[model samples]
Target: MIFDSLDVSYGDMWGSHQGMTHPAPLSRAVAARRHAAGMEYAVLLSSRERPLALVESWPRGKWRVYLFDDRSWRMQMIDFKPHRTGMLLAHRNTRWQFSTERERSSFKWDVQETTTVLADGLVEMRTEFAGPRGASTQPLHARTSDRSSVGPEPVPVRLFPAPVEDFLCPAPEFGDWQVFAPFLAQQGHEPATTVVLNDVSVDEGSGPLRATEIEQLFSSGACDTPDGPAVVEPVDAGLLRITSGRLAVSDPGWIGEPRTVAVPPGEFLVTLSLLRTTYGVDVAAAKVTFSDIPPREWEMALRPDEDLGLLGEGEFYGVGVDTGTVAFMDATRAVIEDELDEDLFIPLDGRFTVELPGAESEPNLIAFRAGRGDGSYPVWIGRTDDGQVGCVVVDFQLHSSGAEE
Candidate 1:
């Protein structure tokens, strides 16, 4: 697919940053702003996904350019000495003249390099540079794939002034941003956050649908969040319905819960919810539970030779604890109990005489709280000979959050 825009930046010998950007209508405008602020930049553009132009402004007064004639697949780089007028006027007039060039024979530029490349589907052009400080190579790649499936087409380059107020606003050109967002953010430009909820599977469908398709399926409008106005949309996917919102969160202390939705019988729903903030983003999996499904027929099964011991009970407790296991448990009771607060009963040593959907039938099923603060504690259930229920915990893991101590 043809990318709407691409930006690359590097540090020069003087420690000042230099940037190269491609195919963005706002690139020239942003370059002008940066140039006015004393930052060097090179704005690149492509016509019909071919290298069209490169405007460079460095050391203030001197301007260099690389122009491409798509019809002839020809390219030429030149250094243009500005008029005696101020740098800003010289830069603007030069840009306007280069853009309005009608005939190739009328071009007036000091040629530096020229080459011709076959205009295939996607092209990669490599250019080399050498100076007193060092040598470096820059590569330019462009694609002309269909963009209609994703979103709106890019805004064309216009000489008209860009609206500064809309610089941070969402634009149609920034379609399904694969690179634009991080590129702008790296340049200290804060673009509007685009929240995408993907891998959404409905009970009626066998595969996931795109977020844009889901948004179109549902009616969308504005809603109020703790931070400000947010857009909320309801997506109906046959047997399931999902409501999603896109907004910014200024306060990190805000607390929210997942909304409960009813699901039809004999089906499953798995989806992801995402939120993008200025600092970073948050993601959560939607949890779906069924209340109408009947409980599996079985009972808690005890080992034939194991003795039932008493474990202290406050809010919840378990039975059939071996001495060694019980001692270990008692030593870490505070941490274990704090993690297992959600369960009514914690099985230390026991097996449920029940048949699990995806498990093999066996006895002596043991169970315990597994995983760290961010992981899951899954219960294992098995069947005994006497038709009793036995359960067990097979594995436990602790995940590191990578937080500083």
Candidate 2:
């Protein structure tokens, strides 16, 4: 994972010994190098070469490192915590820092000479790497644990991109979106697209949306308008209210430190709600509605007397008695193909009258009984604007008092 060390070319003077350890004897020298009683190049005395620990003359603590070239430099270390009570310093000229956890657990680093403080009263140590001056030395302090002094844990704040710079991508945030019927219509057959927070972008004439050159609008600010919340009211008058005001959307931790809310996905009418004067101002609730319009009559047709038995298959064309005044109908279609799902299908206080121009004055039975004796009955067909189909039934009753001529 360390990109820098991936391409290190070992020189002849440096020979790598995996899982190698030397017994103490003080031979004065070995190969072309020599080590005194306290001096050594690299030591691997642990049982295994894993949790591999490096024994460089250096201090140890929690830290993050970036392997640049063949050198391991500490990039960030806010507050490091050491596991063991030991000091880290560099060797005479060949000290190295092992960053891999695979090395830390296996290396046995022994105690070396500790430096005393003069004025500050703080003990410190100077660690070496590569050569005597190969690494930097830092002031060391004793680690302490204070339970009573603990404060609330710091909540994590994440910037979309770490180390934000000028001309780079601007910080992303949510925007307020209002409902517009025209925009909703553009949604086509797909479910209405609800709006959500998106990155600041500009539409270019050609290819894709290019990054805008202007600065971010709501980096920080607040405002109270006489009208209402910026993203509160509907954007377009054409947009019909579906759900009067039963919708809301929120950010992660909009409540406490880490909260999440639900929001529909689609292009929306939004406004800048983040205000500078206010503290922690946010768009909490978003109210939205869907369109609901009763289907209108489109067209109508007439069916022959012979076609009466074949009902439900086609629209109710028209009904007429053979020898009676035949009542022709002006066919009108149903707005939607699906039957009304709710009892509300027959709108409350809403009714329409169908006048049969010609029909038998008196009622009859037998062949006139339109129903199949069960609940099923013959029907009339009608069509609607969007090719939706509808049906109506025509039943005949026999009147014993008014006998047919």
Candidate 3:
């Protein structure tokens, strides 16, 4: 028998097969051996420096292979047959090649079946053989019949369990309206009718389509809208003031003459051509809403004044991981001078959920916890590589076990 049932029986569990003699820590040792068997060499062609590394076994087999990029986590496997001399490569839907002692030239071939076994497996599969060219025409005969009485039973397909159901993180809901950052529109594959953000370096969309005009308007904050009195007032050199609603500065660096824009009641759109500080020239747009106030009741709802300091650091900084809103502490002496008696909500680790506006997007909320109430907020906002913005809250209490202090 080529394989001893008591030694290398792979498929299912039987009586004595489970009784393989293993030393102390047997389970871990066995797991480590299996893990080692699952490792394979991969050469990442893109990177110049450290281009080679040991990756999980390629879907193909327990051997070495080359990949153009080390990007995707999942991969497809390639099938092969070991020849009597070395190895015969079989590739029809694969982008790889192989070599052996019998062939020195590189060539491509359609899928084919060859009556060959590994150079090592050949020792048992060959009949008559020469000195160096070990096996030739004849194949070794097996005494056991293909339908032997003691042969393993044909395993039913139902032996394997069906794949686990895919997990979908709970989507976020909005009471009325919300704002969203840029995210890639995965179109139909992910969520189409819901909020979707763009996060791709390439300006072109992922699927076969062009970005919507709304996205273009948001990217370059400049659009044509009917004139109205400006409700925002410039408070200082670096800050501006909005009375009650949020301030949407299309151009961060665009500082024009101080002017007022009277916003109408109910749903309204305010467009501007703002400038960014860093890049030479870039513009984006923002949409604001005042649902409670009716269009005709604009004068009664006008609260056109602001504490300019709110427009600075806290406006763009200290974004909560879950809430998708920028929060900051009133650390300034001015607010404390008046004895505001408000809780100084400093950034501590916290998480909140967010439903990006416009396109269908996943709900990203925020959560954070404190470690001994360290006064500092644990949650902070950061930009992803694809321009998608997100937040993360940290809890110091949970980290006590690993704390160096």
Candidate 4:
């Protein structure tokens, strides 16, 4: 059985399945097999790249396929059959998911359909196939048609204990949340609104959106810098200690797989622009300043190969926030090569968090609650007019109630 399971029956005690396996998206073996399948399809396309990678047919309602990008074809998304979803693999990350068209429904009918590819790779859902039903761990349950069979039932042999309720990691306790947790949580997804922060490069936000207005945020009682007025609040709780020159802005949960930017190795200050809005307080922005020099320009910061141009006017490339938290950390901390890789449970809303007792040194990371809850947020880079980077900002776009002019 080449990449297939053999249905071998050794009587009642043990049995196997035919041609089946589960998805080990991160497994090297599974990836190799997936690539092999893609390659077989690649050969059929006569070496030309195509959106449709591979296809396999089985009894009715079972048409399996794989989709990927090639030199000739790329797909932003595929309107595929979801009813019979077997397994899905997105871009590089094994543990990935998808969000789809809200107005439309189903596969949109058609055994064969054409869809566009993102080509950028990061946001792509590249492969999916027929799910395999592997051999069961125990014998299949059966009921005897003959009522007489129950009188002499085989001594009920215990199979396995009940499943353990799996909640591997409970939310870290409130006491465990550092002092900053409460401060960070203070600014919330209030007014239940979103603000689109424009790239510093495209500064059309005349009143509040402009980066120029950024330095002037603390207008009256601001620190005077060579560039302009600044309300630079130093993070007394902790700092982002940079051992490696690269700076990374990401969800703290993925620090092990650091995607970074080169910078001078040193300790940097992370500042948050907090504002009291109509509904509640909001974290307008989180910035990591590299140096004292003022930024004269801003650009959408992203991993290399990600095209900012592809994003619409208000659209931006963003990192995932799975635990209602995001972080700024040293680039070196991320050691995952290609292996592709927390809300402290309860909301102690008014309680203290963020500062760990006895934890006084500079931290490798600073994670705070993301706007509202788990979702995606974008990071932007601020640069001096001469091209020196002054700061990095993760704008939650929550400050929709524009500041007074």
The lDDT for every candidate, in the order shown, is: 0.25, 0.20, 0.21, 0.38
Q: Model 2 compared with the native: what TM-score? A: 0.14
> What tens-digit string does per-residue lDDT give for candidate 2 at 271-366?
221222223222211112221222244222232222322211121323332221111111111112142212212321131111211123321100
Span of ten consecutive residues with least summed lDDT in model 4: 9-18
Q: Report the lDDT tens digits of candidate 3 across residue range 206-305.
A: 2111112322222333333222211211111111222322222111111121112332222232222222332222112222322322122111011244
RMSD of each: 25.9, 34.8, 27.3, 21.8
Give model 1 RMSD, 1 decimal: 25.9
User: Can you write out model 4's per-residue Cα lDDT over 1-405, one digit (the tens) per residue?
Assistant: 011111111100011111112111112222223233321101011111121222222222222223323221212221222122332221121111223322112222111222222333223222231111232122123222443333332322322222222101122111111211111111221111222211112222221123335554322343433323334332332567777677877765555544466777777776666544444444446777887888877766667765433322243457677756666776645423242222332422542124211134433665555655676666667787778778887766553322222
How much is the lDDT of residue 166 in candidate 4?
Answer: 16
Better of 2 and 4 by lDDT: 4
| Candidate whose TM-score is highest | 4
Ranking by TM-score: 4, 1, 3, 2
Error of 1 at 358 (Å): 68
User: Higher-TM-score candidate among 1 and 3?
Assistant: 1
lDDT of 3: 0.21
Error of 1 at 193 (Å): 40
**lDDT for predicted candidate 2 compared with the true structure:** 0.20
Runs of candidate 3 exceeding 4 Å displacement: 1-49, 53-93, 96-265, 276-282, 291-405
